[model samples]
Target: MQQSITPQHEHEHHESMKVFGFWIFLMTDCILFACLFATFAVLRTHTDSPFTGNELFEIPGFTAETFILLTSSFTSGLATLAMNKGKVKPLIGWLAVTVLLGAAFIGLEINEFMKMVSEGATISTNAFLSSFYTLVSTHGLHVSVGIVWMIAIMIQLKKHGIQSVTKRKVQVMSLYWHFLDVVWIFLFTVVYLMGVM
Candidate 1:
C-alpha cells in the first residue's frame, strides 16, 4: 500500500515549517540588530562632539513618527483581518492606509535627519553620530523595504484574489509588519528615550 497525505495534514505541516523558519530568521535579524544597538549605546554619549542627541533630536518630531508607525501597525493588523475574511476591498483599503502611514513616518524621519545635518550633526561628525545614524537608518531601511513588499503583495492580491498562496503571503507580511513595530518600540525606548536622558 502507498502512503497518502490528506490536504489538512499537508497544510498543517507547511504552516508549522513556515512558523519555524520565520522564527529562525527573526532570531538572526535580532542578533544583527543587537550588535548595532550595542554599538550605538556605547557611542551615544561620547563627549568628543559639539553636537549631541539633546541638540539633534527633536522629541516632538520623533513622537509624531512613532505615532505614525504605530498607527500603520494597527492598520496592517486590520488588513490581515480583512484578508482572512476574504474581503478584498477592505483589505486593500486598510493596506493603502498602512502604506500612507508608513510613508508619512519615513518623511518625518528624513526631515528630522535633514534638520540635524543642517545644524552640523552629520553622521561623520563623530562616533556618536555615526552609530546613531547607522542603527536608526537601518531600521528606516527595513521599513522602506516592508513598504515595497506590501505594494508587491497588493499587486499579487489584485491578480490572484485570495487564494491559499496569497493568503499565506499576507499572513507572513502581517507578521513582518508586527515585528517591525515591536523593533521600533525598542528603538524608541533605547535610542530616543535614553539619548534624551
Candidate 2:
C-alpha cells in the first residue's frame, strides 16, 4: 500500500527536489570551470615567444574589473533579497545596478585586452599569451552574456511583476551571478596573483 503525502509535505518535497537539482547543476558548472582552469594553468607557462603575463597584465585594469564584478554580485544578491520581500521597485533597481556593473566589468576587460594587443601581446605571440587571452576573454564573454540575460529578465520582471516564475528566474540569476564571482576569485588567485608571484 502507498502512503499519500500531505499538501505541506508535497510542497516541502518539491522545494527539496528543486534545491537538489540546482546543487547538481552548480557542481557540473564547477567541474567545467575546473577543467578550464587546468587548461589555463598548463598553457600559462608556455612562453615560446614574447607576450607573457608579466608583460601583459595590468594590475590597475584588472583591479577595476574585479571590483565591478564583485559589486555586481552584491547588487544581484540584494535584488534577490528585495524580490523575496515582494518589493518590486527595489528589486528592479538592484538588478539594474547589477547589470550596469556587469557591463562595466566587461568594458574594462575589453579595454585591457585592447591595450595589451596595442603593446604587441597578440594571441599568436606564444602559447601562454594565447591561453591567457582565451581564458580571461572567455570569462569576460560570460559576464557580457550575463548582463544581456539580466536585462531581459529585468524587462520581464517589470512587465509581469514578481510572480513565482519571475522569482524563480531571479533566484537562478542570483546563483549564476554568485557562481561567476566564485570563478573570478579563482581566476584572480590563479592567473593574476600567481602570475605576479
Candidate 3:
C-alpha cells in the first residue's frame, strides 16, 4: 500500500522547500552583487573627482559600521539559537537588537555618502565615484530591506510565538542577515580597506 502523508509530514516538506528556495534566491543575489563588485573594480580609478577613496574614506567611521554589523550578525545567531530552544522572548529580544544595529549601520553609510558629497565627491563627479556609490549603496539597500524584514518577523513572533512557521522564518532571516554581513566584509575590504591602501 502507498503511504499517505500526514499533515505534520506535509508541513515538514514545505519547511524544507522554503529553505531550499531561499538558498536559490541567495545564489541569484550572489550573481548580482558579483557583477556590481566587478564593475566597481574596473571603475575604481577612472575618476575626475578631486579625492580618491584613500582621501575620501574615514577609517574610524567605516570601522565602526563594520563592527556594529558584525556584532548584529552574532546577535542574530543568538536569536536563532533561542528559537531552536523554544524560547520566544530571547529570540524577539535579539531580533530587536539586530534591528537597532542594522539601523546604525545604515545611518553611518548615509553619513559617509553625505560627507563625500559635501566634499565634492558627488556621483556625477566621475566613473569611480559612480561605481563606488552603486556598489556600496546596493549593499546598503539590502541591509535596509533586511531591517524591515526583521521588524516584520518580530511582529509575527509576538503574535504567534514559536510555532513551526515562525521558527523557519527566523531561520531564513538569520541566514539573510549573515549573507549581508559576508557581502559587507568583501565590500569593506575591496572598497574601503583597499581604497585606503
Task: Note the Cα lDDT for every prediction shown.
Answer: 0.87, 0.83, 0.94
lDDT, model 3, position 82: 90
Q: What is the C-alpha RMSD of each candidate to the true structure, in Å?
A: 2.1, 3.1, 1.8
The TM-score of predicted model 3 comes to: 0.96
Per-residue accuracy of model 1 over 90-116 as CA lDDT, tens digit each: 998898999899999999999989988
Clashing pairs in 3: none
Each model's total of backbone clashes = 0, 0, 0
Error of 2 at 58 (Å): 1.0
* Top candidate, metric lDDT: 3
Give candidate 2 misplaced runs (Cα > 4 Å).
Answer: 1-19, 48-50
After superposition, the stretches of candidate 1 with alpha carbons farther than 4 Å from their true spots are 1-5
Better of 1 and 2 by lDDT: 1
With a 3 Å backbone cut-off (N, CA, C), the pairs that clash in candidate 2 are none
TM-score of 2: 0.88
lDDT of 2 by residue, 65-155 (tens): 7888888899899999999999999999999999989988887877888888898888888878877777787777777878888999999
Worst-scoring 10-residue span by lDDT in model 3: 1-10
